[model samples]
Target chain A: MNNSIMILIFIISTVAGYKLIKDVPSLLHTPLMSGMNAFSGITVVGAILTTASAAALHSKILGAIAIILAMINVVGGFYITDRMLGKFKSGLKDK
Target chain B: MELNIVNIVSLVIILICAADIKLMSSPKTALVGNRIGALSMLAAILFVLIYNDIITIPLLLVSLIIGAFIGILFTYKTGGVKIPQLVALFNGFGGGASLIVSFILLLEQGSNIDTFARFTAFSGAIVGGLTFSGSLIAAGKLEGIINQKPVTIKAHSMITSLLLIILLAIMIFGTVIDDYIVTFASGATVLSLLFGVIFAIRIGGADMPITISLLNSCSGLAASVCGFAVGDIILISLGAIVGASGLILTQIMCKAMNRSLWHILTGSTYRKVIDSSTETIVEIKSDGAKKEVHNYLEIVNKAKNIIIVPGYGMALSQAQEQVKLLFDYLIGKGKDVRFAIHPVAGRMPGHMNVLLAEVDIPYEYLCDIDTINPEFASTDVVIVVGACDVINPEAITAQGTPIYGMPILRVHEAKHVIVCNKDTKPGYSGVENSLYNKSNVTLLLGNAADTLAELISQLQNDLQSDTVLQD
Candidate 1:
């Protein structure tokens, strides 16, 4: 994608996101923060590509570390968020 | 030219993400909504992997396995009290990953990278580095490894401004300088990381929730810029969504505290003045001098209506389960019971609610400040379990105080207030709670879980004795 087009998409998506999250109650803010943290882990794509295609050893090492960190962010973030959200029950029986 | 299938799929995934976030607002569908969000992330990853055809299967599989294993183990092993720290750590990891990736991309492209790409990569590196180090400091503070009080040095703003100017100069002149791309990028990263530490350490423990939200937004902004550097549409869209939502959440948190974002960012919100008079009152309670021991069981037994206020200390002592038992016992005795939750009561947003929900407390019994504050005046008794600032009446009664104008639960309005904490020590704000000095408030000092357990057994024994007398 061209740079200008990408910037346009960024602005539009951000506005859409702001509208979507406007009504979230304070009770769910923790889960929302963690869930969004996981989504930002999309950097794993850049990590994988960089690591796999690196022509030098140092570059490869940096890429590997990046991949590990990104994966951790993605996996841990989503799982913890799920665990937190699962605790919220409408009735007492689920507990 | 025909549209690529991957682009279409990416658009669909972004739409799914938007819907998922919207559904997460309600408790009933929050779990499902979170799962769908995760699935959308997975789909985006797969799209990128297949479309780019960058298949180093062995390396990919190994990294994924190790990362997933560690992530799962850490998340499950961490207790509820440490969830805030864990979230902070994970957020830092995300930022660190983007920082590394952007730096590697920049090094590879060298001077051949376009101006726009270079700018995005540089911004990503700087923001990612700041978020990475800043969040680590936040986690350290929450974990008690670092001091919770704000640490400031003279002329800190001057130093920060100087660093900013140097970073901007490097970025602008990098293209003109021969083979200075690596040096300039590294310099920018280091300077930003230093700024992150300065920025985070200046905010006290009381403002951590808002700080965490801001850092979460920073990581999202960094990731989105990385997407621009790498030319990935899915990454760009997801990152933007996270960035924008996190910013909105930060604003909401600021409003909850009745503080401005600028006030928080400038690190001027934490007041250093300690009211000496309030300290003397706390000393009287803790030193057992003229200590009036009001029997909590006796008072609770006679009360027709009761309210329980839980806070971060409740989570610290793992008292929610015991609190639940007490709630059930009170209801069994035909007493009116409800929970009053302050919006910023816990370390993170909804911390107390999550703790109570874990122990099977029904959702309907939990009430926000607006809903439950009006009832406090008519309530027979208010039992505050490990909460301090939220119930501290100084927020309304005292002017020129740090917490003034911040809406509280109005626990002091009840006919009687029973405060349960380990000690009369000040709360996160480092100021003594003026509510403790009120004549109607009685102090019960002990671990929250232990005190609540004792209260429950006492109530049960009282009930059995009453039955014996009747028989």
Candidate 2:
């Protein structure tokens, strides 16, 4: 959780992600994007921490809104991605 | 030792996510991969709840349930044609969440917050606010709620630059001065949101793929910076991964269109709208047109191999079902049929494939431009359904046009070409489609759904009579 370690983790994860996504064919780019959208919702963790540690009522209310939004992002993104990937069927096998 | 335990657990979760992405590379395993990803998210949330001891927070639990319900409802109601808009909308939600978190941290941290945390909080606010507003505009445009054409006021570029400079100044002031963090941070947030509007307003619909990808990156970057503000490693690593994936997709879309990302972001490629009268409409079934359709029909009946090229126009007309019918009909007749999808064919990357798949067209029949380009020469007929720029020979032949040097499907190389489009007007680039003038091409201009239906019925009648005659 140190600043230097956080920066190091970011760099490593970014590079690994860049290499990993390169293998996904263009055929699934839309689903790939939506799935990443879900991951970005990891902000909900920060939202919870911020809300819990807040000293004032208004700040807690704002943090709760953030939690709701991020939850929507995580749940909706993954669910829709699953829906899309499910739709992709092999024609040869189906026949 | 407790911190080590936390770090080890976080690393395990990150590994799970990485494996999930690896599984997404193939269709067969992507469904399981997505489920695994959802599970990983759930685990991360539960881990945070237990570690932070926030499980007793009634408001958080209520909010989660409400958010989950809304999310599921929205996704369930969204049809295939509207997937891009839905993605953009949800992406905006993620950005907005980061912005709110950053705002809360900035306001509540007081004297104990370090300079690095304060700086990252400000940075997160800026990026998050911009992504939130920018993505909403993008979603609106995609949904037809806002003008799809670029809306530019006088000195648009100059105004955008001024807003950006102000936001940067406010961010710096909030970070360095610290005395008026509340006031300066609020100013920066508003200005950043304004900048998002200015940034997205001048981008036309055709440039949406790049804009969406770029905004996707900004949302992730925003979350990562928020993690830096809070010193959370899980948010940092996951956000970085999403950011990198978005950047890669942006680069791919830019390369496919032969446009630099900078030009797109700066709206350098945008020009004033041209007059609609300049578009030439070659009506269907005129004396000369009749003869061309007849020739195209004769060629289609005998053609052994066919490739169907679909564009955004196909989506606009909602003709995917009709296209499916044609595909089925052609395949039934023993013709080797394939669909050629240009990288930027629809509003986003791989949009055409998703649309085709929604109608039960198999993934095997969908081929990217690179894979289908070489086969066009040997193809007996190329059928263009509601597409223009991707198949326009002007992309390769003409110089100084907007589409010059951009990759096309090489539909012209086929022995015969049948174009079923709304009109002979130029595509999003406004460069004339030289393919329309080619000798071997036949234009059937109308609603793509109607034109395709006519083509199918014509083929059905012709082929049916031919079989009867042979019998």
Candidate 3:
């Protein structure tokens, strides 16, 4: 079982997935994004891993840099997202 | 053939991920469901690190759990980010992480130039860079911190097109630009990021969902590419899953607006006043229109069945209580009362419902278009309060109109239609309502609550006088 072959399969599927998504209609976006927001949150973990893994690795410099960027993505992502959702909350005054 | 506990654990984690797809339908539970799924995934990854004896790090697990708790707290605090902005931020985060991963692998692989690893490294970095910037723009728009109106850049399409061409040329012909190839890539990343901001801002509020979805797809593409760069199969598969789903949602949104994805993304949409004439409809003067209001009450009092259709204007004018008052008055005298609600009525979804709910209107009396539309024929008088677009007869009667196919309450289907609105002018799209011109429609010119309240007062006075005459 070559890891390279497995990686190629994953890449090919992702490209195909992109093509599949490109073909869908635009109306379902809000619902779809809402649904994916949960799953795509894997990035939250990716954020911790970026710095955590990098710091432990021999190249402390790269790991430290990765930590900073990952923190930005995590903190910024959560902050901005909450603000955006807030706009739709309560109710539209119908104006 | 030896299977380790890490392999067994990974299989369990994959199963958990597969089962988590069911949470998509009812997103109220998505946060909790995803956290559990994410935790399962983190644990599996942790197991991989430990089983291989790669390293023993307890802080990562603690931080991961803490991060999951913070995410849950966010859901409670802001009530979870709305779907579009949430997606945008998620895409950005995903892309940012993928970018970092690609960069790390590059440091390792750059030592051996011309290797497959280098190709993956570059691919991941570029895709992640694009996704990161694009997501930021999308997030900014949805968050309302940025203007919802599209930013009209000078020479917009031409600039983006030229940039893409130059980037393609640079990527293809490497020899001519030898000294600073990496620099060119870096420059392109900046340009893409800048363009991403401009591209997102170019889309107005009505179209934010589509842009966010497209960006979601981009982030997924970035992740898959990074998976390639770092040789990770699981990441690529999951990226494909997300990218496909996001694009499907994007396309659905385009169709709902009766548009193509390309036109929506590329074309500039604005609130244009299409050739409208206030003159052609025999514009009754305000006084003449006021006279018609008296006759309308007579018809309403005499009607056997009545359905009231309320909309945004009614809510804006705080007329829900007034309508509720009218409902009680009518029902007290033994007249039928019901309400028609459109699915996408007002400025947002279910807006009318929320307003009516506030007024303590029974849910049973309130019916969505599917159930209440056909019942309009049986209704004798349909009093539409501050509801223009939703009750517009043009939606059902005129095929040439922009709202032609769009579903609307069939208030006009009643024997008599009473339209109460502030402005004689058409609604947001400026489409002349056929209901306004119909002989059966008696236009009421005043604030919704004021008009309805006054009408009720007039009816009460007349009833008392008639009783006196009978005595």
Find the candidate with the highest TM-score and give its number: 2
- Candidate-wise lDDT, in order: 0.83, 0.89, 0.58
Query: Which consecutive 10 residues in model 3 chain B have the weakest lDDT in total?
Result: B22-31
DockQ of 1: 0.71
C-alpha lDDT (0 to 100) for residue B143 of candidate 2? 93
Candidate 1 per-residue lDDT, tens place, A6-70, comes to 99889999998888888787678889999999888888887887777777889888888888888
Compared with the true structure, model 1 gives a TM-score of 0.92
Query: Which is superior by lDDT, 2 or 3?
Result: 2
lDDT string, candidate 3, A12-36, tens digits: 5545555544432211223335444
Q: List the residue pairs that clash in candidate 1.
A: none
Which model, 1 or 2, shows the larger TM-score? 2
The most accurate candidate by lDDT is 2
Ranking by TM-score: 2, 1, 3
Which candidate has the top score in DockQ? 2
Query: Candidate 2 at B148: error in angstroms?
Result: 0.7
Off by over 4 Å in 1: A92-95, B175-179, B269-271, B274-281, B284-298, B465-471
lDDT tens digits by residue: candidate 1, B160-208: 6777788777667764564779988888789888988988888777688
**What's the residue-level lDDT of B277 in candidate 2?**
23
Q: What is the TM-score of candidate 2?
A: 0.96
